[model samples]
Target: MMGVAAAVFALTVGAQAPAEGSDQKRRLIEQKIRLVDTLINSPAARGAAEGQEAGSRALIRQGTQAIDDARKALADSRYDDAARLADDALRAVSSASRRMSPGEGALPESAQRKNLQDLGDQVAMYRNSIEELSRDAQKGSAAKTLLGHVDGLAAESRQLADAGRVGEAGKRMAEAYKLAVEELSRLRAGQEVLLSLKFDTPADEYAYEKKRFASNEIMVDMMVAEGRAIGDKRHLVDGFVEEGRRLGVQADEHAAAGQHAEAVRLMEQASAQLIRALQSMGVPVF
Candidate 1:
């Protein structure tokens, strides 16, 4: 009985040794996994942080410049200029924040959400301000000056878009609202020059261009005729006259299609050819 008990005790010790060894191996494996995970995340976090910092720095610079410009304008008693500059600076700051924020992979959940929300609000405010400015330019008797602001707004919007600040770019135009108000004011005040132009449509403009070319041909032909009559400078005169006639006939077609600008241009070209022909023959200008 004593011998059997000793054997059983020995067997139990052996079993315990293997179990403990297995546990240690498992712990080592788990620790290695954790270390690798940490190693992978460290670089990604750093990259995200660096990107964010760079973006922030850029935004700060833009904001500073804008503010400086505004202050200068204000000092000069240029209220409108100051306001526009301030608005532009604020917009730059908003755009930079979005670009600086770590992409989804890098930022902690909370940071990303906050940044995005702030960006949205900034865009909305910019749109509103721009719309007001646009109207003021159109109706406040300084429409031309307002046009410059409108252009600035457009440029800023484009810059934000190019800078990967997409949300700001999509913001509605504040200038449009301002333009409407200005238009209303103009209607009531009966302003001079009403900011209007009879710009021809694309089709009309294209037709006119064709007519101008034709007019050149006509003038070329007239030059050739004179050159033939004058003798010796026939080759040069012929070339001009032929080109002029062709252009003039083309101009006529354009004119018939109601392309007055084209017809006029072509007529002028024809005249040029006639002059060239006369000059080549040493003929006197009539």
Candidate 2:
């Protein structure tokens, strides 16, 4: 009776253990899936996803080149050096992925700057990881082959990371940031130029006035987009005020050109245009 009872207990315990193990695996898989989803949806991930399909051939070419390099390094018995290079190559691939990710596009300037800095840090981390592995690679032929495979993977990763959809997305984000900075600089420059100009003649004043008006229009559009992205109401209001000032300047320019009646018409028109644009944006432009 004792022996029979012990067997029954042991079997029951074994069955319950398997069930618990299965549950644990399911939970782990779910967590991993969530992590993957977050990475895929990231701006950098989006950029990376964009060109990957079309850039597969280029990535293959890069991988091939890297393999050739590794083969030469191995022949020369620079095993550790080859390993480091291979690791660096792998990091390039990772960088490419980051560059390609689409979600990076919507990032604000401060956020985007941090992203680039973080990528540089990640590269450093990969270098350290690779160096640690290189120690084992020096021990034997099997380790060399393993290292070689890792090298190939790194090469391929570097190749595909950028050439794929993400490269173009990275370019767009870079351009957007550049344009924003340029626009902001232009506004500052225009302000300085306006203040410094010696408008001794009407023609000189007219040119300066026209230039200022044009600059103001550009600033308005840029700031509108920038403000929306950064959620900055102050930038939006400042843009509106600049627009108003532009109209007033244009009216003065017309009067300087000996067209008082036209000046009056323009002044009224400018006010209406500014009001309409501001109102549409839900701004109180009074």
Please write out the lDDT profile of model 1 over residues 17-100, one tens digit for every residue. Answer: 445564443333233223222322333334444555666556556666776776676567554455456545544443343233
lDDT of each: 0.44, 0.40
TM-score of 2: 0.22
Could you tell me the lDDT of residue 132 within candidate 2?
41
lDDT of 2 by residue, 185-222 (tens): 33233232121235566554544444333333333343
What overall lDDT, based on C-alpha atoms, would model 2 receive against the true structure?
0.40
